[model samples]
Target: MKIDSRAASRTLAEIGNWRAVLLHGDDAGLIRERARACVRLVGGSTDDPFRVAILDADQHARIEEEAGALSLIGGRRAVWVREVQDSALAGVMAALSLDTDTLLVLEAPGLAARAKLRTTLEGHRSVAVIGCYPEEGRALAGSLSGLFRDASVSIDRDALTWLSSVLGADRGAVRQEVEKLILYAGEGGRLGLDDVQDCIGDSATATLDDATSAAMAGDRVSADTALERALAEGLSPIALARACLSLMTRLGKVMGWMDEGKSRQEALKQLRPPVFFRKAESFGKALERWDRETLARACEAVQGFERACKQTGSPDLALSRRLIAQLCLGPRSFRG
Candidate 1:
């Protein structure tokens, strides 16, 4: 039936029998995660031969026929579909509405507000929809903490935040990087920021850490080098500005705890994953130097920069360059 994801997940967890589900999310990873979670919920048999059969709209006839099939030798059976486009929703609706007794999982990209299939699932009396959005901030932190706990391992808070800042917004990508960090745990019972830094690859490294650090430190050379490298690597000024804004946001929250009677160590423990102790210090200094007003203004300016990048091409290059330069040069101060 049309159900909120929380309830659906709960139902799946307790009843353990999701006859048919339409698992929807903004990203592939979230869809897959929800799907796996659903499977786990149903107490599906793993030892029996199972199917990961994939079907597309072009093969609607095949999909419909397959959906009607009875469970094979498996104790439980599941059908998972990925990269579902809007064009396939109608057929998907038909397939899902049928009584299959099989788990028909639909993994689609974000649906349009007016989409027919979305409407169907939202209003369906027998189907469940799980929504997964691009995760960040608290959600990402929680996911990281859960990962460590599930693995019976512990991660440094600073390491988690630092790791998150480097990884792109993709939930799957972040999950992979965290897994790598866990793998890097080696023989040690506890993993720290240094191990994270050593294990994270160049692509996932928080380049902003260096650039923001350089800017905060008032090291013009380092900031300039980082910016140049970012540009060379194909990130527009808007991207850099947004990344910095996101970074500043998390840092500001950590700083807020300073006045909350929470020690840094305690705060770190409280934080999911964790922000690096060193980066936190730099962010604290930057916060004071920039102040609340300046940071807000800078974030607004960055939005404009993003618009310019999206609205034009070569002509906007100079404007973008100016924005990046201003982001770096805007008055520096240190609060010791």
Candidate 2:
């Protein structure tokens, strides 16, 4: 069974007869979070020695054998395998044939489309493959809100939007931040943007908005200041690049909608991860400065820089700072 990360919680609640699950994705944090969530749904605890058995990816034979073993605790039992790969596919397949009395949760890196492990589990009637990918936009915001909602921590819209924009690229980071926010807000406490700002400082000591908006508006001085400050505060170059990518991606869409004659308000409304109301005016300024062709080129440049940063021996921070400076030069500069 193929399940989406958004629907995993619901599916887990009604897991029915399914006993074997494969949770694999590029987002290790999300994979780990969902895998543990599944374990809890099955009435098993990861910390319980008697009810849980942790196995290595290479322990194929052991995985199958232990999964079928009766637990001494005489209640729910589960087998958790970490770092599964193609080599463990055969053993995983064999384990699925055993009883569904005990739950099996396997975690692996994202496999290729033709990978047998993904195929077999996806095809199995009693098996599930919960795909965990890096969530973005409204989905990420909604997930964050849901977590806070579960904790009964009330947060304002602006605060929620800011948190979503800054922290959701990493699931573990999001969880960690949310936990901190919950503690800061306390039970049943109402939280506003200031509370979030005080508790969860933006990466680089400056918001992505400051750097991205300044760059988009072609304010070289502000862009330089923000970029330098953010870097000094320990923000990763890859993270800065990603922030540029995100801004341009949205700006490009909004630019397209404006080209089609839609009102700026209407266009922004259509944007997922809805733009925070306070930032709308600046986003409009960005839209005015960027035409379709220029925005496309900007996106390409940012993406290229991202790839460069990932290469071995690259001076990622310096390269990213230079890119930010170039982008902040605005449309005419890029055109020239």
Candidate 3:
């Protein structure tokens, strides 16, 4: 009952029979999407107040009772438990024992291999645990195809390649871009590379990429401009801050290699997406300004900022912007 990315499509297509499903991964968008798909396949709708129930981690104590209750609207019931982790395992186990037409969907962040909930769910015949990591290469291309196919949109190979590259790892972003493309294509319209270029070119993703690069490279003015553009394009501050944290984490790895006697060129060369030729100098400068320890601390700060952003009554956007600005100023400011 453990599903990898390659098998995700088939599993999603035939998910109706699953009594309990745990969708856990770092990709929040994919987890939510799959959780929603599970509800849809089981003939449940969030719009229906009585048939569908959404619960958070703290409300898990009610899960067992909720799952056993009959649907008021007279259809299959779905109980979606968000943020399921070690603490919610007890309630999950209780819900799993229910002999009813209820479908239990548990949405959680990335769980470790040895995680109790993951192990238990994967060991059960009636439970399914899907690992929703980011897809790449052929897998990414195939996912894009499936998405466009579901939308009933025709896309040429070249366009598919271009579109896939333009889209990021987030499934939600992919869904939004595909939805936009479908609207642009109208009914039964065939799309080409030019169509993708025209519709999704210079999007928030491109801007955010530029901003992260500039921010890490110590170019405050450029980073500020790019951040403004990204924010203007409707990219949330939390998303942008998370991107910055990812970039800094990558940069820290390169810095660690350099400290271990690797040349700047060699270190940058080792990066998966390899630093761009035009920005190699900036990356080198970033390395010169911050060391491994500082990057580690900065990562902690970014993580704390993310959590604070999620807390009730916090001005997440403003907090994210302020923290990002501090990061752009360098590790010295980050520590202060």
On a 0 to 1 TM-score scale, where does candidate 2 land against the true structure? 0.80
Those runs of model 3 whose alpha carbons end farther than 4 Å from true positions after fitting are 72-74, 110-114, 156-159, 213-220, 234-336
For this target, which candidate reaches the highest TM-score against the unseen true structure?
2
lDDT of 2: 0.77
lDDT of 3: 0.77
Candidate 1 lDDT, 76-99, residue by residue in tens: 455666656566666666666677
Q: Rate the local accuracy (lDDT) of all candidates.
A: 0.61, 0.77, 0.77
Mind giving the per-residue lDDT tens digits that candidate 2 earns over 154-263? 99988887777766355765687789889998999988999988887755523555777788877778787877777776666665666787788888888788789998
In candidate 3, how many Å is residue 243 off?
5.4
Per-model TM values vs. the true structure: 0.66, 0.80, 0.70
Candidate 2 C-alpha error for residue 272, in Å: 4.8
Model 3: per-residue Cα lDDT over 30-61, one tens digit each? 89998998887675566577788888877988
The TM-score, computed over Cα atoms with residue i paired to residue i, of candidate 3 is 0.70
Candidate ranking (lDDT, best to worst): 3, 2, 1
Better candidate number, 2 or 3, judged by TM-score = 2
Cα deviation of 175, candidate 3, in Å: 1.0
